[model samples]
Target: MNQDDLFIAEDNPQKQIVIVAMTGHMLLDFAGPADVFNCANRALELRGRTDGYRVLVASPNANKQVTNSAGIEITCTYSVMEVSGPIDTLLIAGSNDVQNLDDPAYQDFYHWLSAVDQHTRRVGSVCAGAFALAKAGLLNGKRATTHWDRSRQLQKNYPLIQVDPNPFYTRDGKIYTSGGVSSGIDLALALVEEDHGKEIAMQVARRLVFYLNRPGFQVQFGNLLPVYDHQNIAEKIRSWMIGHLHEPLDVVRLADHMNMSPRNFTRVFHKQTGIPPAKYVEKLRVEAARKYLEDTDSSLEEIAERCGLGGLVSMRRTFLRHLMVTPSDYRRAFRTSLADVIT
Candidate 1:
């Protein structure tokens, strides 16, 4: 059966979503997920149904006013201790202050989190909030992720937790963790889909003017170079590859452009970019093909040739290998969706 046909909406009860925030918390980490759930609730209400979710922001302090990392203040509806039970989902917002983990004032908050985790149906962290979860022993032996910059530190601090930095979000049993700030929206959208269906989730995404779904494990970069220390050489090569996507870009040719031997260039590129030159070139080609597929009426073979994939079959293989979908399926899913015309 086709994947699109499998996403029929079903009846779902209203769910309680509590977003925990503290002073110095990243603003988007709290607001992004809250917006997604709010949008989903609005969509449900528009369809003559009751709200699907009730979102509340909570803080650990009595003041119930938290200052974000950016110095913006937001008020919380409840103190952490006052959030009533049988929670459907509990999301912890991240902060830029790494020292928050060591603050003695948060000890009681951690203990409260541990108790809350026992009754919460689903628990999650946004961005660096994974650090708090790890400190609480909730992420032990589970695969989790946080902001790319903090992934190494999280792994170093908690050796038992598996840190995957690539994906936008991750799920292990009832716990979820998202990468960076915006990924919180992606996680919330996935939760909506899980609780309701793709139909409602898509409605929510459309209302929010966001992608219906960006798979959790999709590579974070396409035309952009991967993180690297030696950025000059990598950037030069990446720019050249993107500009010359329709040209033959074997490692030998790329190496010659850099005035280096193919072997030496390949080794250095891998060291700096964390991916082989061939794989990087393929990603560029696929990115080009994706644009053509989404925006034009070009045939598959034409797009393949234009993107320098050589043939339709080769392009299809590359899309499957990197994107986990066939070229045609991708075009169908993305092109006809609201993403095409909304923005």
Candidate 2:
């Protein structure tokens, strides 16, 4: 083969992927996958082979400069119209102001997506970019995922699309969807495995120092860490709640304990926490209930009392609020997952 043909062959032994970034798009979502693709290229280079992964950035206005969520700017090479030929992959990265996507830029972006649908081998969205895909009517009746924060909104707005909300990435045929920023790394690792081999993908992950390939069943990041701001009173209240799970916790009592008037406490709490005191308390209770369910051989009534639910009905409500599963079902899944980990 000639040099040009060899370049094309290496550009896509399987496919050439295009990454799309709209205005105010998330930096990490784009960067994470780009890092993986770039690392995969390095892996290919190490083997003295042709570059296997190729990525291009395209925009609606064909602007070369793209701003990130944190206001960092990145320059792009190709415009949406310039990428007219068959593309193997189309990845839409998320934006901070998702509502701003209703602008004229996105109308042009929609046309580009429609065009891509005709020739692109695979389409995917990272984070709230799923909104863009859904706007283009590409996600209907397809399994997909987006950032955990907006999964419920996506589900509410687009009932036709199945929002998994849990997986690092969901693939239904050629359409792929992934959760928020860091999950893009996992998704790209998955693609690397498919394109090359598991060993190559693992080497890429090692270069990136990634701990896990993908979380089991879309485990929400919300569950892995505490969300309270350390300097805020919400942190204090959360600490108090954790320590006093067995205590009687009510909005009035919580407000009194914080030494603020009920209304003022409620306002500040909601303003700082993005959730009401009652809801926060419920979350803490449910979290405690889950831990007990997973780690201890406690009866339902005992677990309820330990979690300070006061009654079976309250415990069930709390469990359903956080887990979307009954206490028993949650316990069963947790135990099964634990067993798998141990094995």
Candidate 3:
């Protein structure tokens, strides 16, 4: 489809974009995609055509004010009970509350979702919102993704769903799922591209200041390390190492804690874990630092000190060696809430 393809007014009556805003949902889960669709309309109007996309945000109940993760109250225009028209596109903006089946918020949405699936032209989710679709059984036998941290649990909870944790977004048939908050924007942009082609999509992207239309297959993070078998000190050593990542851990110190000679313990540890004690300790530190960087706003110096990386310079080198990215770069890419800046 070209920009000129939109000049046919009678054919396209504008896609009715219905976004179901879950209670306690991430603000950008719906808002980011909503912005993309809105931008698409702007791109269309700039080409002297009016019909493009009409966005509608709905909550569990009519005119209900739902609080978001950011503590901002969003009053949805329509409730699931009020949504009667045929929807061109349907999306569920995810919430942490969706983890519980007993969550009252899921009640109306799930029932409404299952029924709407028949009439809705396209259906999708953003981040933890995939839980809603999965619960409704819409995602069963479909390739899906959510936030990387929750992807494994999603697969486990709904065994029929093929949950790939890496992608920015995924499309299986008409169902789409994205990695996290900002990834919802990527999914929406892709939908716009499908509807309006590359030129209009590019215009929307440029208007939104998005640098790239990141492909769906790109891995979201590098923290997916192998699950090593620490048969020798399964629980004890791993727990202590995590608790004391801020402290210097030499082989002698570890061996003393394990009640064995340093040389003897090193040999046994290598035989079981397939890695030297020093390298293992370094990997633990990197994992600790990565956690801190992702979940907290701690300064690099403070994170280095906490993770026992000597200082900022040493921490950078260690992260580069282990994760192939500098610590700052890692934080920039994976620290979450890129949507905070975007919105």
**TM-score winner among the candidates?**
3
Clashes of each: 0, 2, 1
Give the CA lDDT, 0 to 100, for residue 72 in model 2.
81
Candidate 2 Cα deviation (angstroms), residue 13: 3.7
lDDT of 3 by residue, 133-196 (tens): 8888899899999987787788888999988877788999888888778888899989999998
Give the alpha carbon lDDT tens digit for every residue of 60-92 in model 2: 565656788787877776665666555677888
Better of 1 and 3 by lDDT: 1
The residue ranges of model 2 lying beyond 4 angstroms of the native Cα positions read: 1-14, 216-219, 223-284, 288-306, 309-343
Candidate 1, superposed: residue stretches over 4 Å from native: 1-17, 22-55, 68-72, 81-88, 95-121, 145-159, 163-170, 178-224, 227-232, 291-299, 329-343
lDDT of 3 at 126: 86
By lDDT, highest first, what's the ranking?
1, 3, 2
C-alpha local distance difference test of each model: 0.81, 0.77, 0.80
- Residue 111's lDDT within candidate 1 is 83
